[model samples]
Target: MKRLHYFMIVFLITGISYAQELTITGMVTEDGTGTPLPYVNVTVKRTSNTTNTDFDGNYSIKVNLGDTLSFSYVGYESEEIKVKKNDSVINVTMSIAPGTLEEVVVTAYGARKAKKSLGYVVSAVSSESISMSRSERRKARRASKKSNKSLNKALSGKVAGLTISNGVGYTNSNSSVKIRGANSVSGAQQPLYIIDGIPVNKKDIAKIQHIDPTKISDVKVLKDKKATSLYGFRAIHGCIIITTHKGNYEIKNNESYEEIVENSFEKVRTSPLSTFSIDVDKASYSNVRRMINNGQQIPADAVKIEEMINYFEYDYKQPKGDHPFAIHTEYGKTPWNKETQLVKIGLKGKEIPQDEIPASNLVFLLDVSGSMDQANKLPLLKRAFKLLVNQLREKDKVSIVVYAGAAGMVLKPTSGINKNEINQALDNLDAGGSTAGGAGIELAYKIAQKNFIKNGNNRVILATDGDFNVGMSSDKDMKTLIEEKRKSGVFLTCLGFGMNNYKDSKLETLADKGNGNHAYIDTMQEAQRVLGKEFGGTLYTIAKDVKIQVEFNPAKVQAYRLIGYENRLLADEDFVDDTKDAGELGSGHTVTALYEVIPVGVRSEYINEIPDLKYTNSEINRNFGDELLTVKFRYKRPQESKSIEMIHILKTGENKVSKDFSFAASVAWFGMKIRKSKYINNDQIKDIVTLAEENRAADNQGYRAEFVRLMNSYQTL
Candidate 1:
């Protein structure tokens, strides 16, 4: 009996030992060179647990006793090892797979191609080298406070034929990288940068000062004509492609967007009036396009139907009378549901010639925080601002204020004619430290107020990812500050950049409260559209506090639902209250709004049954014969205090619509489908695509065509 008890106790103890979980830590290195490989995928055999090596090739994963861990990396042999009873650490040494050199090569757009398939020489640097260099740089920075080594500088001796030169004139802190030497005499000579499949503008190459070297899996330099041709004419200098361990795109994103609540059908007999602020900002459309192009999941809140509809220019007539904008209305059968009717309201601000536009006092409030260190943020911003600066005239004045840990004035008020000086100040800027956005805004507003130009276009252009970590960073705080500053006659322009950690909600609030506009610059093409081609429209606000109020006639309508602008909805009394804040209309800008309506005697699943009123009469008045709706608009001149009102009347008649109306409806439908609205379904997406394609009128800029292509791409996804 004693022997049997001892055997059972031993077996129980052994079972407990086998069931115990242990954290296995290790370093993965190349066998021959003994160099640490970053982002080496380590997975537990048969289990879902996995991890990747850090910058120093260190990794840790939890596993049970007798479990096996596998280490795998591209172009290298994979290995697996079993955990022993007493094992706590496991170090792996990987060797290059046979013929790896000829079998694989990293190419542009994060695609891998056979080395022999490319005609030009493709120089490559392993992540191990980058990690080692970064570690050394960090140690050096800690030892010497003045050391400001950048990723470009770290690659000086790593790749053959790649030259690194420290920038001259504006800032010695900036470094420029060249693959095959200077190929252009006037234009940018640096090679185009491709990070995680997204192309960074070549002109912004110098702004690519810093990146988290730990996240980089590998870097490849594509030199020579054949290789450069893949990226178009802009890649004349060459191309540098950096791939991350997260595959072609970063998945650990912290992008924030405001919540959107879809509008429900309202009973016209009870709620006849629908009021909202007119929105001209098109940031949502472009931002959504960026997400789609990156092959990322589209956030429902990111699809603002109104913005998407307004993104394309409409064929509305310009204002001829005293009004600053012209209004047009159309009624048609709903494309998605035949039981419902669609109403489209369009507004076109009068266009002003560039020379005729008012002179300006501009304050550039730039975020130089650590979050903006990515190639797409600060660097892209610099290139974008350069385009705006090139359009400035002699009468314009400019000042620059940057915030990173603290706020400071980089350039005093200077004439816009001094383009070289302004450009120099912009080029000297670099990204580092925490964001102090509120402090920066206070300083920028102070500067703008001090140099306030009466009757002139005075504004602050804030460029950031909206990740404000230090000092008064909340949305309410920003809104309050902007609202107070707008009383001083200084408007705001919020230009957003970057992807991860983007604070879209805060930026939108700042723009909405400060009598300003907001736009997200996702690429050089978008930058050109916002800052170059539409310079006057972007800088000069023709009207402010624009609000729209529509009263549906119960005789012609039963129930109605506004398509978008959920955030812009205002109280009915706010329509007539000049104290209430609304949207600003830029010169030459267009705004469009859509409404889904259930005509009299028509039924829709969107409408919910409501009990009859107890005391009030809910009957339709036939006295308003054939009247569909009455639309009233209120707006203030840029320098005025009181508001001007305009009215337009629509009558029920034949449902004739323009191509613009059809296209706008199609965009709205697409937006609804993406937002997963109950009003739209996947089956109708094909119809939406066909409608967009059919109504794509003389699309001079090819934006409509691009939308069609995006629709097709989305279907495939």
Candidate 2:
């Protein structure tokens, strides 16, 4: 019946490529300030389709007349417009409404219902919440990583039940979010994060296109059981419905940026970062003695690099940037949202080209494994990869390779210039049979080698769930094979498809050894993120073998542990060894890491312990203090066989007057509170949210603004 319907629809619509000329344009704003607000929601009356205001406070949607449009945003009144004519531009202002965090959302079968009418309790975290949290952390995650934004040290108690793990350090690769204790144990326990009606898994973190939080306008969370039950087993962990705010304007700079930043305040609710500051010393560490006896070295210098970096205290300014997100919200209520936490969020950050990114010659190797039968898996993969295909340039080229019971090459090398053919190939793929992943891999590499774009980005994109049960299945043996293959001028980027028994352990090694990136494609939007938005970073390689080693002075410090990145951790010597496998980076990408310091002058337990065994060489040079921690990176031009090195010198100082000092720490607290790890005590979620609230950025992306509301809604449960 479905096929018949589709056939009839296709037959009837065959000659209607150019249906009609109709235009819809409008401006969303805060009712109170008469501010042209960005991220106000706008949706098609009878459809799930939606769009948001751009940074310029304008939206242009192309649709036929007679379509009813809905408008909504957190802390603002909602309105609807009827499209009755062509070329109409309607400007609208949305007023702030009390208890606005509560908004309606869609769940399961695309139902619509009011927030006040639902029988079950649900919470909506709009894009606003995501933007707020992203802002506090973006500064630290960017280059130079030198500046303080805002944040409190203790974030555990701030939100009612949100737990914060240890608050010692902050790392980009590590995500602190673990919803309501460890539910999955080994598998992902995080509540599914759905963006634009697409479900995404936690592993998608690495694939995130450095989306400016400022571009996002709002978000809505689904926290109730019945509300999420429609997703079946997957929703047992709960759901977060993210609504991104956008505008359809063409302004990529100042005009839209300033307006969006000002409009963000209409929903701002708390002040935090300025609420308090804590002093730490060796005496503060509870287990300095145990840490020292275990043979850990401490820094002798009074300055703590981790603490200083953790709070964004450096002089480095944000790089040049452009907001790419376009958000739209509808005025009417969604099917769910019994207790929605309507959040408006966005990422407003800078992007700097890594010197110059290499051109790319990519072979998209897909595994049509039978395991990819779920909606969020292979089906979404097709849509997402198409988004990336649309963004390629003439200099880039793409090829398609797939494996099922047998391996085969689906599409030969095609010019990235021809998006139509690329998309056609992607759309034609189907999933069936057991996975013969290895054969497909070899074929992809051979193709990549055959058409190696000299001095450019040459890599194979392997998309799969990492389930390689047939042929070349052993992890140890596979490691050796990848190592041998990596020596070729070709690099690899492993894109994981689907979840449920995802082989993360294998995918991690493959990408790390092949000197590429590991990303999980859980949704079509993420596919756009990994392929289109970050084409340069995802397909090209600028830097490889990136490593960091911090040597603490036992005299000044007693004990310290890394905050996160348990997976990316490397030996101190590995920092300089080019042969050892390490992490790779793309153009215009930023990585951040942080640590907590216990000063020497203060009577802290962390620095009080003495080593049972003396050092072999007690004498040290004067440069020891200058070399607290060394960040060394070795990389070859994407097409080169050997590698070169780049170095950054880091020195720490204590200062209470620095703004850059606290902001990075604010990011750390946000991460800790989200993960609920055991590293932090006496910390609360409320305090962290409060800190983020206070340290809102001059150019907020709706992140901190929304975080305040999510923290508040946690109380309703």
Local distance difference test scores for all models: 0.84, 0.51
lDDT string, candidate 2, 436-528, tens digits:
877887888999999987787788888777777678866676688789889886888887655444565566567767777666554343454
Instruction: State the local distance difference test value for candidate 2.
Output: 0.51
Query: Relative to the unseen true structure, what is the C-alpha lDDT of residue 551 in candidate 1, on a scale of 0 to 100?
Result: 99
Please count the clashing residue pairs in each candidate, in the order shown: 0, 126
**Please, what are the lDDT tens digits per residue for candidate 1 over residues 1-717?**
999999999999999998989999989999989877765878887554666775467788899998989897767877989999888889999998776332432332455578778777788888777774646766745633332354565567998888877756543344667776424544446677887776764323433446545667888888777764566445678788787778554334677888999999899988999999999888999899878765678989988888888888989999998899999999898888888889999999999998998889999999998788776788789989999999989999999999998999999999989999999999999887678999999999999999999899999999999999899999989888888998999999999998867888999999999988899988667887999988887889999999999999988888999999999999999999999999999999999999999988876777778898899987668898888999999999999989999999988877779999899999999999999899863446679899999999988877887788788768865
TM-score, cand. 2 vs. native:
0.55
Where is model 2 more than 4 Å wrong at Cα?
1-18, 21-83, 87-358, 367-375, 465-481, 496-506, 520-533, 553-555, 601-611, 614-649, 652-661, 698-717
Find the candidate with the highest lDDT and give its number.
1
At residue 597, candidate 1 shows an lDDT of 90
How far out, in Å, is residue 27 in model 2?
Answer: 8.2
